[model samples]
Target: MNYLLRLLTILFLTNLSASANVITLQSTQDSLAKYSIPELIGKAEVTKDSVYLNYLEKKDLSTEELANVLYMHGNILINEGIMDRSRQYFERLDSVAKILKDPFYQFVSKLSIGEVYYRQKNYPASKESFESAHPFVAQFPEGIQRALAKAEYVYFYYLNGQFERYSKELEGIKKELIDLGEQGKVGDEDLDYLEMSKATVSVYLTKAYLMNEDFSKAEEELKYSDKILKERFHNKITTTAVQQKLTKGEFYFFKKDFKMAIPYFQEVNKLGDSENFGDFQYVARVMASIAYFQLADYKQSLSFSEAAMNHPIPIADYIDYEVEAMRYAYLASKELGLSDKAMQYSQKFLEQDEALKDTKRSNFINSILNNMEVSQLENDLIAKTKSNYVLRYSLIGLAILIVILVLFTVYQIRENKHNKEKIREFMHNLEESDKAEKAKQEERRISKANAEINSDTPAQPDDKTVKILDKLEEFESSDLYTDSKMSLSYLASYLGTNTITLSKIINTYKEMNFNDYINGLRIRFIIEKIKNEPKFEQYKISYLAEVSGFSSHSIFSKAFKKSTGVTPSQFLDFLKEDTR
Candidate 1:
């Protein structure tokens, strides 16, 4: 549970660059872009403010320039932990974007606003802002910005604990970005940005994969992160250095390798920003405190916990808002025999534990209620402005379109029926031979069973595999395997075998890898239902795929075709024709 917060924040950083990378990178000179946000640290605040003021004072800036300034200023403020001021700039950007009909700025503005609300612990507003930005995803020209926009939403999905959406959105990001590159929509300079961004995405995906408990994927993402960073930045970039060390620490920390994680945490603490009052100083300290506490080094744990307490932890990272330092401090102090300090820490932890939790939830609820204020205004305006002629014409057009669709659908249905007749003719041609073959197979099976039943003794390592097969027979009688998340580990848990042994059994007996085996079962199950159930005959192809345990309709279609020599729709149509 303690690691959950750490896990989510780590997932957010590589994707949410506008919040400055989950929040902000500590001040640095290495520019990721013309207006790259460097996290404001100590004296760096003055320089950032001066830049913000300069942008404000300048009068001759063009629309793009002004939008860039506003976006940068908002990012700077958000990174500096200035939520109110950040929200103002983003709102201003949103207004300007709407006036200029610039969806890019509109998207950026909403995304930044979401980050601000997220950092402010206003989850509902954050979610709303992210959703608002979603429509603008396709509005950007195909390039890094568009990919990044989708990636930013991926961060939100991950942090909101929507792992399925997170994984899907993440795959979309990779595909879109890589596709853009392959299509030559990206130049060399753009390639550099893409590479770095991909590395960042890979880094965060480790946390996302870990959250879904896909340890193998997590490890793969982590290793890819290391490889990409070494090739691109070579640990020279300050943010890169910090993120790499921090992510490694988090990875090991989540693995419960407290001792293994310590060195990486130490490395992060050595980084320029995490040393002083950088954004991650509190994170490093709090996590280090927890790690040490886990190691039973109470004195060191208490020291780090108190150090964490001394800093203002931002809401950008997990557990930062509620401040886990006090919880560990209480335990560490007690372990160290410091009764007075332990009591004080315990009381503070208790106060924060529930109070912060409730405050976050209530803030989200309040935002939700407050959001209804003027939403109907636009609807009312649209309603008033619509003339009867316009409405009538629109309705007429819609009716025409519906008629066209119905005619086309009817034509398609006739064509399908024709195809079905041909298929039936082919089946009828083979029906006699198929019946003969089936009769022969049934005879052979019955003879084998009769011979086995007449045996005096039953078969006894045949023992465990046979036993497992029996349980599997029982299991296959139910719909449990229809769960979309019926992974190897999950099946192992149900079968009472370790994952290793289960894999062996599946490979030996099922004659396929785990994924293929599950998919095979799903296809067979759906085919059986389609054959026997009249209601299921009316089920949409995608819905059938889902009920049959596929996460994607495309995948289900492919698998079904491979297994049965026809698409699900084709097979279902065939079944309908056969029954008639």
Candidate 2:
């Protein structure tokens, strides 16, 4: 009877351990079904806790169960946008995953932690976390977790603005996700979501491409996004109106179609419930103000700016808005000849500048990390030496080193503080110089490219205008335009001509405004680079624009498309066909 009872007890314990591992998977699924599904992200905690409690009541769980629970809890925290707390849970999960001998779980936990930091805009920490997890992912066998990790790796590369890597990873992940969808035989909704995920990745890639001055490719990607969204699941996700509107608004804002951007912001404000409001309303209002400002509607801009300042929103977004709003307020007041109001806003702007005193504090703190690490190593050496050492002189040497180290650290801290002051002063001067240079560049470019008509009859042309025009044409022909940042003022200065003369020559002779003249030169330059240069064939169209002086790929593509009546890619294809 005793032997039979012991056998049954051992069997029961074995079953319990096996059950804990698989049972938590079901618990996670159920919690995610009710909480994360339908995008009820706000109720995640309540639903998650209830599921965990039910699971706990039914079975005695092991260490693996604890780890999985913590991981799930971290997921819930992430959905709530509580990154710091989510990181702590993931760290705990990391330890548990190591003990459970599951490298795959550890990789996922670290990947999630990296994602949280990424969302917080803590790029350094995010990069460290992702890179650290890469080795673990390599060790782990292929599965859903590995696929997700690859997707996340693609995300990190995209965020860091590594366009080439982002492109390759995006293509790789698309094939993998498609294969996974087929293997699982997942239904249309799941496949739709996976495709949407790919579209979102493509959007970020396009953003990087745009920044890199590859506008033709960026437009192509945007069209791809449009195609994906137009399919069965565009706004079909059962998310809240506020959240949906916020995303759509950002999409248009990035595209720089501020006219289309405004309605989405307004929709978010109109439909969003008050109790759930936090940063979204404030952001929408501020963005709407910017859109209005861009359109030169000063009244609406001032109204939106004033409303945003008064909104009881969080401070993270306000640091940027407050500074901008003060400028707007001052400008509008000056326009109305309200000197007192203008003076008040100017004072507020000065105060805003004073508030950013700690901008260099993080850099100083980061510089101390290596010193701290060395100190830690020295302390460990001393502790181990304490048990073995017998020499009084050895002890004295350590004490002397420690005292010297302390003094050196104090001196370095003081020096760093002094240097910070100098750095700030240098930065202030640099900013002023940058502003002056920008003004000069803009003036020169406008003068050369735009036809200036005074309300009175146009002033007589300068006597040296013909010579200046010759110099301008010569400058346009030179390789200097390949600098991309080469401007009319720069060329005028180089040629010893005034910007006005250069401008008059460009407008009169070329019949083009400053931007158009330069852009036309740039486009022609890019065309030559693509056709004559073999090395540049691999270069994206946007890159060609950057090398030739367009600010963004979208602008480059639009201008190119207008000129050729074909997209840059199509133009490239045409070039290739002609060459063949």
Candidate 3:
């Protein structure tokens, strides 16, 4: 019985190993037979190079098949962060495709080369490669491939900071997609690819808008992309989701909401890891480092910054993020008193910054700068004339009135000179009397302080009064005054004191009644909020009043005027002027 059982186990083990071999063989054959070059390249983006290469080497292939394999290999190397080796594969494929007269493959190879250049921050070379492929890609029939090529061009434009060109190209591609659908050329499968491409393009556009600080438009594009991705690609669209999260994180980062930005960046890193989104993963790490640094979590900031810096993949094209990571790492190390690490990171940061300064001297950036300069000049001219037609007309009429008034002013100046001397004499006499009155007031204030100090029995606070004052200070520090419904009774209960004591303390220390004290705190809080958050200036008077704990706009306006010697609107205007 033992011998029989041993034989059965051996047979089972043998069969299991045989079955695994068969499955592996079948997978290799299926990959070689079933996938197109483009599909294989897409697969290379997510799969391990070893697995892809194992299958790719198993099959005997034709020249075209060899070219496709080479392309996939190059893409795998790129994913593995081996750029020099990847470029060799791409160059070989380009040559093979040209010899084979495969325009599609040729265009794809050129685009790949351009992507390599882009990743290297060689913008001129990247632009040249992309331009060389454009005509070849355009010669293809209107289909998913053509649309994808056009979208790639738009992405290139965006990366180069040609936002106007990116916008125009995106609109043109969108119109072309609509036209394609209207012509009934888009079958169901074609529709799927088209929608995916559109969604991908929208994600890029969202990032572009974010970089330009157009938050509303960025949000619109993100929503649009997410909708299409959900309806079509569903959970499979990990890259788009990662891009959306990164853009959203960037938006909040710019808004100085570091707490909000951190979660989005963390989500992007999580998704990127799970989905093997190599590029976005590094970007998310860098952004998380920045957010953590901004939040003053030096340890967390250093962790993320070091992760980004040590990433095998080159994120050099994202020069800003690269410099920021170095800067954050330097700052975190310096804060932690790691002098050696801090000096190392600081040196790296300075080196990268200097390199970036040189890169920024590129014609592409110069063009952008020149365009911005021209835009500013045009804006200034428009502002000088006033954008509104009515305002322009009013200004012109005011100018004519000013000219007439100037003529009258010259004649009046001679007649008024003698009258002005008489008026000045009377004003000087009033000033002297005012100075004497202020001196008397100052003396009276000193006399009161002296009387209080010299009194035989000076008033002193008892234990209960001291306790109440301490609790009142705590209440004020707690921001309870910002609560619209907070009353003397409510605050007194919160502080474990009677309303009478609370009111007495407030009147004695603050020199104001409960209502006046609360209103004063609320007004001060609102002013600080407005100063810190410029967007608060755009709020309506009622909204501002409500947020500042007022029951009504009228009450708020009256209190604000009394406390500030200016109405709320006037105060807001003053804030705006100060900001300018």
Query: lDDT tens digits, residues 101-143, model 3?
Result: 8876687788778777776667788789888877786666666
Clashing pairs in 1: 19-23, 25-39
Q: Which parts of model 2 have CA positions greater than 4 angstroms off?
A: 1-69, 72-83, 101-105, 115-123, 138-147, 178-193, 213-216, 219-230, 238-251, 268-286, 297-580
Q: Give the residue spans of candidate 1 off by over 4 A.
A: 1-63, 238-241, 272-277, 317-321, 356-580
lDDT of 1 at 351: 67
RMSD of each: 21.4, 23.8, 25.2
Model 3: worst 10 consecutive residues (lDDT sum): 1-10
Model 2 steric clash pairs: 213-542, 214-542, 215-553, 447-503, 448-503, 449-513, 449-514
Ranking by lDDT: 3, 1, 2
Best by lDDT: 3
Structural RMSD, model 2: 23.8
lDDT of 1: 0.64
| Pairs with backbone N, CA or C atoms under 3 Å apart (clashes), candidate 3 | none
**lDDT per residue (tens digit) for residues 232-303 in model 1:** 768454354466577778777766778988888776665635334255556777778878877779899999
- In model 2, how large is the Cα lDDT of residue 371? 22
Which scores better on TM-score, 2 or 3? 3
